[model samples]
Target: MSRRTDNRHRVATICRRATGLTHDTCLRWAADGLITRQRPVPDAGTPQQRAFEARLFAELAAGAVLGLTGIRPARAEPALALHADRAREVLDALLPRLDGTGALRGVPGLRLVPDGGSWWLTDLVDRVARVRLLHPRPGWGPRPGPTARQDGGRDPLWRTHRHALHPAEAALLYGRAKEDGASWDRDLLFSRTLRRLRLIVDAGAQHGWVRLDTTGAYDLVIECCCASGALKLMHGLRQSALAQERDDEGPGYSGDIDVGGACVAVRHASCGSFPQPVAGPDLRWVTC
Candidate 1:
């Protein structure tokens, strides 16, 4: 017999938010099917159920919720996807590289260097293909003694950090690129970029990031709300001969670009998507 999917949040799911579990632990659990709730958390599932989840969370807030590693946490993708909607403001600036899917694609006039550059797109597709999870047996909650793998471990975006690509794994994905140092670990650099970009984003109306030295004829701002933003921004500098960056064991595919003696830093989100830039007075060009 089948049952209706309630899509309610659980205690373990709420706890993961405050605890800040490591990415590896999340991945392992996702692989093992530990944190899944009886029903999947809908993107906009139900207001009443969600509010109740919040109330239950408050009730358990005083207890030891963080240490319950056995329970799976709630996924952040639904909220992040919601955030991605606000990122559409910069869609026009990046139109040059967008394809039918609204994803990033190569275009003319911008020569992306660092060879194997196109591979990033290939890698993007590759990573998305890998990394999957098992789902829970809706309405049944946890299985008795774990007869079969069905406890919410299979949800694609099970947790916010569901990405399958990393420097080490990405290296293997690129094979030869790993040997040359072009495809190095980028998570750390990506983290720093995320922080700086968020600073720019949070400082809304200030357009605080655009205090560059160049006084070009035109001012443009580029920022990302999805992964494509970073891809499009980096693609601009790919073919430029003057692009200055560290390719030796560096992510090498992205970084700041210096144009006409002006330094414009290009940054992206750490986990999933990159956002577009915000324009403010005195700031000419901005890209997130």
Candidate 2:
């Protein structure tokens, strides 16, 4: 079958693996206009239809990860609601900003900040806000808790949850990376969108936390480095993170600084040989 047809068939499988969400949930979210107002993909759909579904699923998955600050869950409705418009805005702004090589042109490393009832995408180093969107439910927070205002009539409380996207995650979710003479793998895009996930799996002879799903990691390596370099970069990423762990407090180090959980996963994987980096390729996508 043509790759496109194959991809259409695999969308459900790939989305399930990537988002840990059933096909029904994603479609329902899409139908409810959570992320986008567009109609969900049909069983037999066009490439555009598949792309739309893939993008929405990816965005939803990212929201789930960032909402919980690196903890990926099977379903996160509240997180999805918090991120819906912002995710759409980010995808809208960044996708076209990518050049022919799937790298953001003249963009800085981006950070997402939740303040008050809005989500802002900002320049990481400068703290300059680039894109902002109001949350679907204003003043939304966890349930059954006292907000600052609720406590003795103090100022309205808002906890800012900020997350930085590794360049790879940004590109995978929003960039248009094409393969030579072949349609890019839309299924790969779904899987790559799930990079924020921390998978606890057994490596060769050991068990530890891995950043990328094992199948997704292999597909990424094969796509970028070919069969010969398969797993070379993945190993390098694990090794590099392990080396960094020794110089710091290791996985136990829990400060505000976050590399999208790359630090924690690598430290945890020190005893094993897995865990890809949060940032995919070290290519210079941004100045920061």
Candidate 3:
């Protein structure tokens, strides 16, 4: 095993060995909030804490490697069995957002293992037992494979997730360099989006659906702009709390904004050049 004094390299060693990633890619993932650590701060954490981070990263990265190759990474059966119930609960809560994507409807349940790179939504179960959905690469674009781009492009919801990615995020997720445009204004758009994603993820132990946490960190980002279109909307949003809107499709929750006493569903469109805020049946709202 390679050893390093630098904290980035120390963690990178685990990530690299696990997924054959370059040290720089691992560093970028850390900077981008892609792979969260137990004690995520730099040299400030203890060696034992650091070691734990490495192990966790290794597992996550290893699973990601499997996913990149179009394989659904699974946890050891015993380990998966313990958290089976929790997995199903979380999945139940998340399915409506995934309605149109067709990625999770077939999912019967999930496992506690590394759901891969972003911890997006790889854990899943089918009729027989728990299976995993292949985690996408870090990009808002498609995974690197024959069908990745075609599959991703065809789905409007998938495109909306892509819209959420900033150029910087795109770079890190795709193993590329940070993009730099010739002029400041040209780069502004990407910078602003990246800032938003960074801010949202940093405030979390749960960085949106990228990782699941108890605090419901994803609740905000997934909500559509229509629900909070204006200052008036925010004031209205204060009137009520996010509640589960369950139906025959599945059990799921959303924060609906009261518009003239009419609750408007916050269905953030996952596709199209302009994502509109109107009531629709349901679309799986996975993160970009």
- Between candidates 2 and 3, which one is better according to TM-score? 2
lDDT of 2 by residue, 181-220 (tens): 3333544233223321222111221211123322322222
In TM-score terms, candidate 2 sits at: 0.25
For model 3, residues 154-247, the per-residue Cα lDDT tens digits are: 3222233432433332333354224443322212211111112222222211211222111232212223222223222222222211112211
lDDT of 2: 0.32
lDDT of each: 0.26, 0.32, 0.28
Ranking, lDDT, top scorer first: 2, 3, 1
Pairs that clash in candidate 3 = 97-284, 97-285, 98-284, 108-125, 109-125, 156-271, 157-270
Please state the error at residue 124 of candidate 2 in Å: 25
How well does each candidate superpose onto the true structure, as a TM-score?
Answer: 0.22, 0.25, 0.18
Error (Å) of candidate 2 at residue 201 is: 13
Candidate 1 residue spans exceeding 4 A from truth = 1-86, 89-124, 127-179, 185-187, 195-197, 203-288
